[model samples]
Target: GAGVSQSPSNKVTEKGKDVELRCDPISGHTALYWYRQSLGQGLEFLIYFQGNSAPDKSGLPSDRFSAERTGGSVSTLTIQRTQQEDSAVYLCASSLGTSGGQETQYFGPGTRLLVL
Candidate 1:
C-alpha cells in the first residue's frame, strides 16, 4: 500500500456490541500505531507495534480494547462490549521504527465509531 488505509469511515453500533476496525499500513513501513480521538480532543495513543519487537501495549485504555499487528504490516483494533464513551475516531499511522517521534507519520482517514 502506498499509504495507510482504514475501513468503514463511519460506523454506528448499539451500546455493548463489539466492533472490529481494520488498518492497512504503507509498504516498507515498520512502525504501526493506533490512536483514538474523542470529539475535539487530541489523539490518544492506543497501541503501538514496531517491527518484530514485542508490541507496546501500554497505551491500551482497558482490557475491552485490544489490537494486533500481523506480519509487521496490517493491524486490527477490536473494541469489545462497546460503550457510549467508546465512540470516537480511530486513527492509524505508520513511520520508521527507529526514528523518534520527530519523524512525520502517515495517517489514515480514521474510522469513526459511534456507539448508540
Candidate 2:
C-alpha cells in the first residue's frame, strides 16, 4: 500500500445505485490494472490481473462491469445497475509482472465515480 491505493476518493450515486470501487497494491506487485477515465477520455482498460492467471476481463464495458482480485492483493470494482454513462475516473495500476516486455505501472488515486 505504497503506490496503488484507491477507495472512495469520491463517489456519488443516484442513477441506478451500485458501486464498490476499491484497490490496494504496490507490495510485491504481480500485476493488477483497471482503468477508466471519462469526461475527457484517455484511459479505459478496465480489468486485468496477473498472478493465478485468468482475469483479463477484456476491458469490461458492459454487463454492468465487474472485477475482483482477492488473495493476490486486494481489488473490488463493481458497478452493477449503474448508469449515467458510468461517470468514470476509476483507475488502479501495478506492475512487476515480468514476462517478455513492458513492466512499469504504478497508479492510483482514482475512484471518482459520479452518476447522478
Candidate 3:
C-alpha cells in the first residue's frame, strides 16, 4: 500500500455488538501502533508492535479490546460488547520498523466507530 489503509471509515453499532476494524499499513514498514481518540481527547496509545512482536500492552482499555498484527503489515482491532463509551476514532500507524533507531510513525485516516 502507498499509505495506511483502513476499512469501513465509519461504523455504527449497538451497545452490545462486536466490531472488527482492519488496517493495511505501508509496505515494508514494520512498526505498527493502535490509538484511540475520543470526541475531546488526545490520541491514547493502545498497543504497539514491531514486526509481529508486541512489546507494549500498556494502553488497552479493558478485556473487551484486543488487537494483533501479522506478517509485520496488516492489523486488526476487535472490540467485544461495545459500549457507548467506546464511541471514538481508532487510528493505526506504521513506521519503517521500530527499534532503538526508529523515530516516528505514519498515521492512517482512522476508523470512526459509533456505538449507540
Candidate 4:
C-alpha cells in the first residue's frame, strides 16, 4: 500500500556484534533488492529477490551478509560479526516487475549502521 519501510532507521554497534535490518516492500511489488552505501561511495548491490524465483546473492561482500524475503513481502538483511568496515546505509528497493526495459527501483530512506 505504501512505499518501502525500514525499521531502526539508525543503528550503532560495537565491532564483532551482529545486526539485523528489516524492510517492508510496497504491496503487490514482486521484485526487491538490498544495497549498501558507504560514506561517499556508490551503492553496492547486496541481494535481490524476484517473485518465486531464486534470489541473487552474488553481490554480498562476504559470508557474514545474508538476506531473505518472506511470502514475497517483508525482507531482512543480517550481518554477523560485524566489522567497522561494514558500517554503511543499507537500502531496500522494490519494483512491480523486472522483465521489461528500464524498471525503476524505488528506494527507502535506508538504515544507517555504524560499527564502533
lDDT of each: 0.92, 0.88, 0.89, 0.93
- The segments of candidate 2 whose C-alpha lies over 4 angstroms from its true place after superposition are 1-14, 17-30, 34-48, 56-64, 67-78, 83-89, 99-105
Candidate 4 lDDT over residue span 1-116, tens digit each: 58999988999999999999999998888999999999999999999999988999999999999998888899999999999999999999999875633888989999999999
Estimate the Cα RMSD of every predicted model relative to the unseen true structure. 1.2, 11.6, 1.5, 1.1
Q: What stretches of model 3 exceed 4 Å from their correct place?
A: 99-102
| Residue lDDT tens for model 1, 12-115 | 99999999999998888899999999999999998989999888889999999989888888899999999999999999999877786887789999999999
Pick by TM-score: 1 or 4, better one = 4
Better of 2 and 4 by lDDT: 4
Please write out the lDDT profile of model 3 over residues 1-116, one tens digit for every residue. Answer: 49998988999999999999999988888788899999989999998888856558789999999988766678999999999999999999888874645467889999999999
Candidate 3 residue pairs that clash: none
lDDT of 3 at 48: 82
Answer with 1 or 3, whichever has the higher TM-score.
Answer: 1
Candidate 2 residue-wise lDDT, 9-107, digit = tens: 999999988889999989998889999999888998878999778898988989889998999888899998899989879899888788625677889
List runs of model 4 lying over 4 Å from the truth: 98-101
Clashing residue pairs, candidate 1? none
* Cα TM-score of candidate 2: 0.33
List TM-scores for all candidates, in order: 0.94, 0.33, 0.93, 0.95
Model 2's number of clashes is: 0
